[model samples]
Target: MQFGDFYYPLPANEPVLQYAPGSKEKAALKAALKQLKSEKIEVPMYIGADEVHTANKSTMHPPHQHKHVLGTYSEGDAGHVKKAINAALKAKDKWANLSWENRANIFLKAADLLATKYRFQMVAATMHGQSKNAYQAEIDSACELIDFLRFNVHFLSEIYRQQPISVAGIQNRVEYRPLEGFVLAVSPFNFTAIGGNLPTSAAMCGNVVVWKPAHTQVYSAQLFMRILKEAGLPNGVINLIYVDGPVLGEECFNHPDFAGVHFTGSTGVFNHMWKTIGENMSKYKSYPRIVGETGGKDFVLIHKSANPDVVVAALLRGAFEYQGQKCSAASRAYLPSNIATEIKKKMVAELKEMKMGSVEDFTNFVNAVIDEKSFDKIERYIKNARKRDSGAKVIAGGKCDKTEGYFIEPTVIETTDPYYVTMCEEIFGPVLTIYVYDENKFDDILKIVDNTSPYALTGAIIAQDRYAVELATNKLRNSAGNFYINDKPTGAVVGQQPFGGARASGTNDKAGSILNLYRWLSARTVKEVLTPVTDYRYPFLQEK
Candidate 1:
């Protein structure tokens, strides 16, 4: 394995499996789901080499089947957060000093295992725990995580190959060392890939990490942790813990060795953490690197030349897939008056036809949202939109039923007001709001689209006319980080579109790129002079 200098070419994105009927993948995943559902296991926090389970346990339930207990995870307090930090620090030196190729191989091996050995199980866990249907689980938990692992290894390799050019009889080198202290990775429940990538990306860069995944994601998060262990990750390199967010933050932010944090969640939480870290800056050994991707009130803009069918499909998939839990989901739309009627008619009809239920039944196009809190939040938004004075009329789907599980009907509201609260604020749910604009005033509408929302995470402009497309593109250039043309704003592939946004959305470090990897690294340049300077004097100092 150490025969020569390592060269890992760009890795391809993992192909998303379509678990169609009678497909082998479908059968395997069904089996995995059955197996997981049949057993109730006790999950523990992984601290150093130990599986730390406490009496304080929180039960895990399928979002689509709240009564069915998947398992229980040991909930920790500030003490466990402290332990995780200590574990990361204890393993820091060895993990950082490990051979670069070996470090790279561990992640490579993990990627392979995820793609092959545990593929079905991983997808199954996501489907059950996150309430994601088959295709949604495949694209997110399987394909995206696999792509992140493989592509990260390749990206880190490229980073290691960068060196300074040497002059005559002098050799120059730069060492991309891991940061002096530990990294804290706080990942959200929406994407299991982020839960895995947040910790592994830092650990892959020779920095040890303490990962605290959202409590709702523990079902799949624990599975990925096991895969990492099996893939030869050294103990304490990445410590996984389940704890109260504030307690964990209090401990980590106050610690002197808190090197950095890789985060993905809401803008409010991200802003709070930034403030906390800033307040405790003097306590840290070095300036802590804060990288985060926060909330998005993403948009979809329609033009007169846009195909009604295309707009309908884009809105259907973009707004309701995974119950519109995605941060990049198209929550708002600006439809041209010329084609808006046709698009709305088609969209409403399609929504009526789509089935909604548990992920167990693959035919269900819409599943339950994450949990009760999210269910209530989405319900509030729908209720507010229904008020007569709100000036927004529900065109289709505004039902919230939680008898069996937290389910919200895929709702669409058409409002005459452009900056209606539902359209401006972040609503992480199965709701889409549309505002009709004069077809000829496309440019003016684009300005409203740009200025309406504070978030600039993701957006799309659907148009067949080149001039209209170009105008919207130029006008809304800063409106979205990942701008799509004639396509839904969500579903950004890893290697193809590195995702993140600025202006309160996040630091825009652009995860899945070398830019994110560089945050975990601290560089040191060394220049060896073959001809040593005899004195600290130059020709000018010597009066030459």
Candidate 2:
């Protein structure tokens, strides 16, 4: 069934699932599974009128829709960049003039539409297109999106209704308004919610946005746009495009009206964009805002006093959920030497109990990685682990199911060697590396965790003592933007947990308790007089 302008639902579960292993029912189910695996899930391609007219290289294939063509021009080429900026500038006036109430209502309605009517289709499409597991797709793409939209309305209300402060013998009143120019949103595919939040947050603040979603997540992005349009967002308020990185980057950074870029991706890309913006600083209409969240080599610390259950639960959720694709997904765990053996045993037993199967299988805990490239990357990491001279041993899950979609078993590595490549990189897969810390060399171990990673997106410390937790939290200060005490590093709630990171993670904190909307807006203060006074003498009036 069609969920929106861009989504279709998967076939339903049949009765053959009830059979025991190797039984007739099981045989039929296996055949059905094989057929499903073999089937090519076709996606629709949307084409821009200009691309169609120009007979450009962007025509949609049978199932793939060529939607999201980059702004109708070349990237970096001054003429085309100006054309795109002009298009956004032209759209900004009307979009900004819209009443805050109108924007809020529309956001609410659209969210409701997504949650109630489009949920299943969106879930299935995200699962198919982004290789998200069913639960992750549904929860993150649909449910979390709904939560974000609903929370956004509240955020807007707070921003708009902020009361003027009346200080003793001083007047302090603040009025917030949109940035006058356009915003450029460059999003990633890890969480489809980022697509909605990044652009929606900008539009919420009355900024016109030209959003470029990751190519891999085009379908999900298109479906989201369809929902936004259906909810009565003005035409051109959000301009969707599908262009490559270098081209679009040059265009966005070099444009005169390019107010800022809200980006979520790798550190290398973020750095490049930042450098581009810096290089073209003099050409811009204003100093552009650059808010981004990039890479993360997040960690989990298990103190000697921690509960085994807590460590196990946190690691399972943080490492394996979403196939460890989230920026905050746990990649390293530092354990005290005393509990290292027990923790490893618990982790191994827990991983064994964790089922791995198709995304649609509710009982399956581990799902396929996003695509073949990611699959191969994980395979390579496992191979690297095997080559480790010491300190690294793959305790579980070092195999790939070649016949199926990009599926790899969740891998756990036990190590004392600090130089293990798996321990150092972001990995971005379901490979959790455990390191044992010497009690006498605790400071040295902390230093290793702190300095080993280049990323500071997220980190967590599991300790029973408040002082130890605080000490560890302070020591690994550069680890992540959002640090956790008892919980896993992932699953940050929208408004309550404003998510984003420092260093390579992001410029603007996307979600959490922070005022992220400010990242999308430039403050505008409007003073309206209750009593009109004609041109009276002022202390600092300009001489005519």
Candidate 3:
């Protein structure tokens, strides 16, 4: 078939649904939740077109109600990881050689499906599986996932449209080719959109992928795989498997076909994988691309001139939303001493008024952390702060309970030291630590904030003075990948703020933008000669 010039529909951010009480969306979401709770699902590994099952199985449970079983997933071992890698390699050549327009169309179709028909299902899966409330689910599974697919298509086209300048007698052209081998996409449980994006981003660039999503996220992940399949993604082009991470990592990292990894997880895991890939570098046909986003001890700094209400609101939303499971969640705060007492009073009052429970309860603003391990970690941090007599004190909501689910109160810890453990560490839960600073020492505190953490993912500065804002903007420029002027650090829109951080945070490749798609491709330049010279002798040799 002849290739046709193709232009995708202009992309737009998917609108987030409020799912207000008594609204149609609210009713539909309730029905979906009920259906999900009523039934138990069986998720299998997809290698090529085959649905493979193993003897091993793991039960899926919601973090809000741990006793309630949502489903079971087949857990594959090292053998299955090898099988997935082989399946991806088997499908690599045909998928890579397929017409670019055809490849783009599949993902575009998937985005359309997600935007309309499968919208509620995606949101529902996120809510039921990932413990996100309706609004959170809408923003993540529905909105962000749709944006990733559509924007990546636009970006891929842009990559292809890039051409080289040619000399008078020669015409030069550039082609964006997929990686020579398969990609291994390792996604986290926090964002369903991320789980979908990491795998499809590579696939959209004409590369095959062996995707292994976190076990906690596989429930929504199953729906994502089905959507891709229905959108006409050919079997084996993207193989979805559920396996132990270490086992899978060992198999994929040692395989010659492993071309790259698109990872979003903890720093420790990414570091180990990076070291393993480096040690096994000679075993691969090509150097593998490592694009990762890891841990972040994000921050929020408020100047004395800032509005207390605005600071409180930003803290409440940025630190407590989704129970602070976001890598960009504001974990540390630096408030001017003059306004610190007022901000703390209002923050504590609001924290007391806020409701925390299951996501099914729309009235509740906060939900449980992802699992028991996370809850325990957050609790340990709070407990440790309470025990310390000198550095820090728990000022509000320091309680935790795991009887019903993995629930940790929306905690606020006030610290005397700017570099307190809570301020420096990535708690990854609903915990915010405040360190009040003198109004005159804003510049000194900015330096401390910048140097305090190994992470530099997301951070915000709230100040009314234009000079203060400008100074912080310039001083902390390298402190965060997504920096905000007067807003919270969380809730980064896909296309507008191409997210990802530098230093310990990640490679800063900026997912949800053209740069991320560029990582998955290799460029080839072709120069065509219009005319050939018959004489081979040079004038310089004869005339000199």
Candidate 4:
């Protein structure tokens, strides 16, 4: 297998598993999903100053329906936020008190249920909501989530028990403890696996979660909740709500009962929430823990000694995968002048053959941007690029079909000018912009990349020479959370790649590892079997 080639099973043309025949839970969930689809969920609009004209802000080109995962939305204007939080809060004590084994069993059962019954449906929902083609969506929603579940089982089973250690004069021991209150998981729309695992891990650790999934991915989020409930998890153990960012984020930040937040979103919002918690630190009964993963303007640097084929393939996948919506997606590339022309030709040829169309088309290589706002951002960037003397000419695509869906052609821009906005900014689209640099300018190019963004999510360097590789790696030590060698920046595997970034990205590093679970909790020491026998008083315990 090639270095950057991650194995993902191609999605089957038909559903792989059937729901249990005539099961009440299945029937109820299906009915709720049907109702959600039947009702044209009000698309919140922005009212004009005159109070008469209202711009239709619902810009989802292919309008997506809410999923059946989290049950139905609340009937009134208040919606499900309060009710969901209350459910999780009410179940907190019972969930926390349950044996770690039993809690782990519930998750195990849920994982089994997901694998057997909802895998196909979940993939379908992810495809529908996020425009991730069937194969990619299945990999994210089913395959990856299953891995996370299995890993969590192993993680908890192996480590939940107390360990004993011998000391010269005393016995030493260590044990894991659960958080005192419920956890809040606010996930983004980009990755379905993250949307599930972020909150699920907290629940696995005996922390109840008040999860608010991204609005754009409501369906898949709802489906995940259903799978959890069907797996025999107590109703109040996992509370899910379909709420807007500002409203739910504010409630979570200000609530006295809030324990911790597992967030994945934009840096601006993450910063705002962090500031809010810091300002109101004393309002909570306990300090509210914060963990998050935010934005990235990740880069891929190719040294003069790098293989042309390897560089092209990695750059293509890194820049265009999931339409370049990933935190680790390669948004910029710095090519050594020696191979710059050859690499550009190969990339252009490969990208030219890439199919760009509706995500529903199984063969489509790239799909629509998430929404109109994102579409507008890319549009503005392209417009600005064109305005700049067409120096950064579109090498392959610049067309966007806005009739029925918001689909932008997978675009490639060629420009050596580092000053181009397209070269420096995180466009977050299937747009790859190349910047060529002379051999002597490699270090200077690294400096330019470091200073380009507030984000430090992920980066890669392709080189054949050991000295070049080591030098590039050392220089880019602080440039990314995940540094790749001769590989693409996309396709983070569960249990292997620890996914996160530094600087403004996020606080909680949700790297699909057991280590991330610690962020959802605080440490507590228990002195077990305290003897009545007299012992030497500790110097620290005794007042001086």
List model 1 lDDT by residue over 126-243, tens digit each.
9999999999999999999999998988898899999999989899999999998999999999999999999999999999999999999999999999999999999999999999
Q: Give the TM-score of candidate 2.
A: 0.82
Q: Which candidate gets the maximum lDDT versus the true structure?
A: 1
Instruction: Report the C-alpha lDDT of model 3 over 1-544, residue by residue, as the tens digit.
Output: 7766676655888888888767888888788888888999999989999988777989999999999998898999888888888889999889999998899889889989998898887888898788888888899999999999998998888778778899888999988889989999999999999999999999988899999999999999999999999999999999999988889988999998889999999999999999999999999999999999999999999998999999999999999999999999999999998999999999999999999999888888888899988888888999999885757899999899999988889999999998888989899999999999998899899999999999999999999999999999999999999999899999988889999998799999999888899899998888898887789987877955
Order the numbered candidates by lDDT, best leading.
1, 3, 2, 4
Off by over 4 Å in 3: 388-390, 542-544
Cα lDDT tens digits, model 2, 249-278, are 777776777888888888888898888889
What is the clash count of model 2? 26
Better model by TM-score, 1 or 4?
A: 1
What TM-scores do the predictions have? 0.98, 0.82, 0.98, 0.84
Tally clashing residue pairs in candidate 3.
0
Global Cα lDDT for candidate 4: 0.71
At residue 408, candidate 3 shows an lDDT of 88
